[model samples]
Target: MATLTILKYPDARLRQKSKPVEVFDETLHTFLDDMYETMMDSNGVGLAAIQVGNPLQVLVINIPREDNEQYKEDMLEIINPVFLKQEGEIEWDEGCLSVPNFYESIKRFDEVTIAYNDRYGNEKVLQAQGFLAVAIQHEIDHLNGILFVDKLPILRRKKFEKELKRIQKEQSQ
Candidate 1:
């Protein structure tokens, strides 16, 4: 497995909506493996295929549970995932691998149920809350061409855009 390049915010390609994965074949497995490696290497809990320049509805998440020592075994490889239900609300600071050095407090569902196809083309449903719920919502948004920043208020989003520009300029120099 290889580490894939994660597309940063403001890249037009990141605004593109992803298509669903049709074939559960070897290539799909390889890509998912690479994505998992990339997400781990980047120190992110979740990653969407679109973030890696692949416009497919595939995402991987491994939000380590604090109580679990075998967290690595809990990695989820989701394909064509959709929200089955969402309820309650929680406000939490969220960060994205694609957005880089930015974290914003966003309101998200406190609990969520999602249905998805596994790597082997088996259907599965997952119920998650807390950090896992937040992570799932964030990654699923990428499948629909939505970024966390897009959920920000207008003023806050503008401020973030300015800050992002400054950072980009500084890095270039």
Candidate 2:
């Protein structure tokens, strides 16, 4: 496994929509392993392929449970994920691996049923709730070229504008 370079905010590649994975092969598996390494190294609960400069519909998510008990064993490696059904609504403070050091209250579906191809290229359908659900949706949005910052309210957006610019400038250097 290798750590992939995560594209930070203002990177044009982050705004580019990802392509679907046509064939899940050894290369795809290697990429997924690298993505997992990248996500763990960055301390992010979830990551999308586009975040690492690969514009492909892939994501990994593993949010720890609050109680720190035996969390669900499902460390999802979803390829070409699709939201089959969604229900209810909740507003949660959301953060992104791409947009660092900023959290905002973004409205998201509280529950979701997703259909995706697993790492082994097996079709699977699953339901996610609470934080896991929110994380899933957030990363999926990245595949569609949408950032959490774009979902922010105007006032909030302006509040972070300077910080965003500063980060971008520093990254370039």
Candidate 3:
């Protein structure tokens, strides 16, 4: 599969809420493969369709493992996912594929139980924690037209604003 170009923050498309996948066909599968490839190519642990200029509720995640070779099976593909429940809370340094080279501590659920369809239209539920939980929430936010940077506090937000502006300037040049 070919890697897709990830759209950076402030792109109008990233602000648009993704549409749910209606057809679990080859096209959808192909898109998901490309998304995974793109995520790996960009060295991101997770990605959402909106981050790649597509308005679809699709996300891919592969949390880094302590033993790199053994982690190949960690990748996940979720389509039309819904957060069923969340419990407790944890603050973690979160980053986004859409917003490169930036990270900030954001409060998120320590555990999340979610229901989502697979690439083949089969349903699945996952109880996620730690980095996986954080990644899932971040990607879901993208599907809902939200970015991890939007979760930052006022002071921290201002700090990141300068970097974001610099990235935008570079993109336009």
Candidate 4:
């Protein structure tokens, strides 16, 4: 498994909407493994295919649990997720690999039921709550070309725009 480069915030490619994954062959399986590797290497809980320059509706999430020993055991290889139900409200200090060095209190559903496919194209339904729910929603947004900062309040969004500009400048230097 390779660690793919994550697209940074404000990168035009990050705004590209992902297309649904149509194949579940070995190639897809390998790419999923690479995505998982990349997410772990970046210390991110979730990563979408589009973040790695692939515009496919695929994402991998590994919610860390107590003891942190259950890392890979809880990996969710979701493809083409469709939210079936979302309830309650939760505000999480969400961060993204694309949006480095920033954390925002973003409101999201506390619970969610989503229908998605596994790495092998096996349809599955997951009912997630709390942090798990938030991570799933965050990755889904990436698939739709929506960044967490875009969901922030206007003031915060403006602040992030300035920060993003600074980061871009540093990258170009």
Clashes of 4: 0
lDDT of 1 by residue, 5-71 (tens): 9999889999999998889999999999999999989988999999999999999999876764326
The alpha-carbon RMSD values of the candidates against the true structure, listed in the order shown, are 1.4, 2.2, 1.7, 1.4
> Which residue pairs come into collision in candidate 2?
none
Pairs that collide in candidate 3 are none
lDDT: the better of candidates 1 and 3: 1
Write one digit per residue (lDDT tens) for candidate 3, span 1-173: 99888888778889999999989999999998899888888888889998888999999998988765325478899999999999889999987777878889999999999999999999999999988898899999999999888888888999899878887789899
Name the TM-score of candidate 2: 0.91
Worst 10-residue lDDT window, candidate 4: 65-74
Candidate 2, residues 1-173: lDDT per residue as tens digits?
89988998889999899998889889999999898888888888899999999999999998876775423375789998989999999898998888889888999999999999998889999899889889999999999999998988898898888778887789899
lDDT of each prediction vs. the true structure? 0.94, 0.89, 0.89, 0.94
Cα lDDT of candidate 4 equals 0.94
TM-score of each: 0.96, 0.91, 0.93, 0.95
Q: Candidate 4 — which residues are off by over 4 angstroms?
A: 170-173
Off by over 4 Å in 1: 67-70
